[model samples]
Target: TEIFDGFSKTVSKCKFIPVVCGSSLENGGISNLLEIIAKSFPSYISKKHFKAISKQDNKEMQIEISENGNFCGFCFKTVLDQFNGKLSFIRVLNGEIKKDDEVLIVEKNNKFKVTKILQPFGNKIEEMEKGVTGDIIVLQKLDDISTTYTIGSKDISYTYAFDKLPQPVYSVAISAKDKNTEDKLISTLHKFSEEDPTLIVKYDPETKQNVISGMGELHLEVYFSKIRKQLKLEFETSIPRINYKETITKQVESRYKHKKQSGGHGQYGEVAIRVSPNKRGEGFKFVNSIVGGVIPKQYIPGVEKGLIEGLNNGVLGKFPIIDIIVELFDGSYHEVDSSEMSFKIAARQALKDAMTKGDPILLEPIMNLSVYAMDKYTGDIISDLNGKRGKILGMDPIPGGLTLIKAEVPHSELLRYATDLKSITQGTASFELEFSHYSPITGKLAEQVIEERKKFITAEEEE
Candidate 1:
């Protein structure tokens, strides 16, 4: 099993090994993966055991392997199978608890009891006591228990949390296959996400996707692959799309009047509003300027609610609209029929109409990327970063001709940068990424994205 090459002995090198096995229809690969883990994975004795830091003190607590060591287990990940209900998994670090043995799940200085314990195979069932150090066991029907919880003796008051994982750099629009299955899909996804700290789920109102995003594309691939067998749901997915936001470039004022003549009561609501773009990332703000009760103070919230809702669903091809302010400087509200509903509709209509005249802009996310590469390729690395619209922040030399480079670049430019990095650096480069502030998009790029979204909608509508 020893495979070595010139790359291994290279002075400047970045390395990673993926332990993987899988089969499309038949699932022997998972079994082989289990076997490999059993044979090669470090046990509690071999692993550097950790205890979460005490709440009262910043000091981290360590777990001792000796008999005197406290009974502690880390509930690192959780899985909620639709049929199986809930699976709260923990790795025993010191003392062990047997099946039917109750344990407390500690998190944020709060503790909850495990309802029952189950041994996991392809599926779950009752098992012998999980009484051993380093053994993994799962608990079921736990309501308050969650990931990163410590399970041990109550007297052992505290443990340290693990390092915070990197924030998710990429996102996609996701939703259940069907509206009827939305709740199940969400519950399943949340429980599945409990196990993997890296994956993040976000609801993007612009694209209207219940996006399940992870470190990279491959991370989410495993999640969707198991959705059916475990979660017991067949889901439909929207095409993955980047989250884009919309903002205004100029300020404008306008009025909207919703004068409706219905059978019983006529709805008449008038609003005079001014719209302006705020600083980036500030979100939305509403200023009530209607003085002397020209527009009743009570209806101010109605206009505010409408504007807030509009911000969520952008004016441009359903992107998230952000960084804007609206002021209700003057307006007239009907005492009889003018209510929050009428004012809300009027305000939304006013905003859309005003935005059409006011200059608007599309904004895209920028990413802060850091790369570690061999010193030999420093020159080449700098060139590549510039090509991706990246500005180098700093570079520091590491053990190898190995250099760490910090840069800020547009997220769109680096969508495929990970693969390119490996190829350019002979598979010896590793990089980290974070979301930087966004800037305005040029007319050409914004037009392109808008056209692409419209084309997709048109094609789907045709089908």
Candidate 2:
């Protein structure tokens, strides 16, 4: 029972291949890789292990691979190249897929001709006719098809897809070195995002920065290297920022009015809103209170939208605003100029004002960390986690004398933990993060972060 509880799975697609290559450069060992790839791998048609039994005949039927074409492929990878455009890495699941052949993408509910079908001979691609079922073929120029999309002929029906990849645990903020590279960086990173589903790129409006997050610093570094190759663009990176959240401790109310008169119509909108702290993770809430048409029903969503956008104003300070309800209880609207924009802006300002008085505190992400380490470093690792405000749930020894440890630690503490752990345990320690509930920080530790925030803001303001 203990073994089952502490077990971790190691998955591999094809492990039978023998790897033998010399030199750290020139991309060698690839020759053996190809031989293994071509011969070691199984073909759907030739594989004799698969058998289907029929009840009436009590006989097994083996799907035969003949000259008859049934055109079926399972998507292996999705590539989004800006030049050649999107391509799908497909494995012929059933029949032969050839160049210039018409194929129906059943997943997309559309049909597209195979612009080109190339087989992987090592890394070099070779054009082939009707890649037999079992051959891995490159499906080019299929814009809509994604990874795992099963493409088949109208007559044949068989599906095969790969297992899902692991989730990304590391990420960081990224930006172009120059203004000219902004568009290029955006487009190139998006292509990379499509190629690897785990790689993510997000634009943070508060930070006004492009954040590129992936499995690790190396993962992001490789992307930067590719960006240099793809677009000839250079980049500047910063330490990954901590995802801090702000929450209020008590209920509070605030009101604001925006009225302007210039030439044509006047702008008038008033909002009286109450803010209350919700339980952690509940997120910001909005309520409407209009009895005598003080504010129109249609304008309510406009106000909510504005408040929602700016509710994270406190977010940059590493805090999340949650459980606060706002009401447009009292407000006057101008008949001529009262519009959604005016109300939205008024609502935004009101929320900002209320946030200041809400006594916000920062909350950091907690990770349920499971570490596999040798017994020699167990004491050191546990002590280190405890120093970072981590709580050890328990520890159990595994088959290899490596202890499986469960603990809850803050994300900030584990930024470079992978490297540190490998060093301490001599490449034997490994850990995975499962995001747990967040909690608040106290003492000088919290103060250090506050100072760091001020510096971050000052740097941004200069920008």
The prediction achieving the highest TM-score against the true structure is 2
RMSD of 1: 7.3
Ten residues in a row with the worst lDDT in model 2? 3-12
Kindly list the per-residue Cα lDDT of model 2 for residues 1-463, writing each as its tens digit: 4432222111123423345665547877767766654554444554532332333454655545553656667787887655656767887756677667777776556788776777767546678776876678887676778776777776544343346576666666777778887888888788888788778888876456787767766777888887778678877877677767666666778888888889888788888888777777666667787789988887888789888877666743634455566666777787788988888988888888877787767777899999888888999999888888789999999988789999999989887776677777877777788788778776677788878888888887898
On the 0 to 100 scale, the lDDT of residue 396 in model 2 is 97
lDDT of 1 at 320: 69
RMSD of each: 7.3, 7.7
Once fitted onto the true fold, the runs of candidate 1 whose alpha carbons sit more than 4 angstroms away are 1-51, 54-71, 77-89, 93-102, 108-147, 152-159, 166-196, 199-203, 210-239, 457-463
Question: All candidates' lDDT scores?
Answer: 0.74, 0.73
RMSD of 2: 7.7
Model 2 error, position 34 (Å) = 8.5
Per-residue CA lDDT of candidate 1, range 1-463, in tens? 3433432323113353444868847865887777655654444575455656875676776755743466787777787666877677777777767654545555644555444556666554666555577667777767666677677766677764767777664455566667798977887777667777778776765555687767655666678887877666777655456677888889999998998987888887899999998998788888888879888878888888888777765667667688888888888877787888888999988888877777877888888888888888888989988987778999998884689999988887876676677779887887888888988887778899889878866786897
Candidate 2, residue 378: CA error in Å? Answer: 3.1
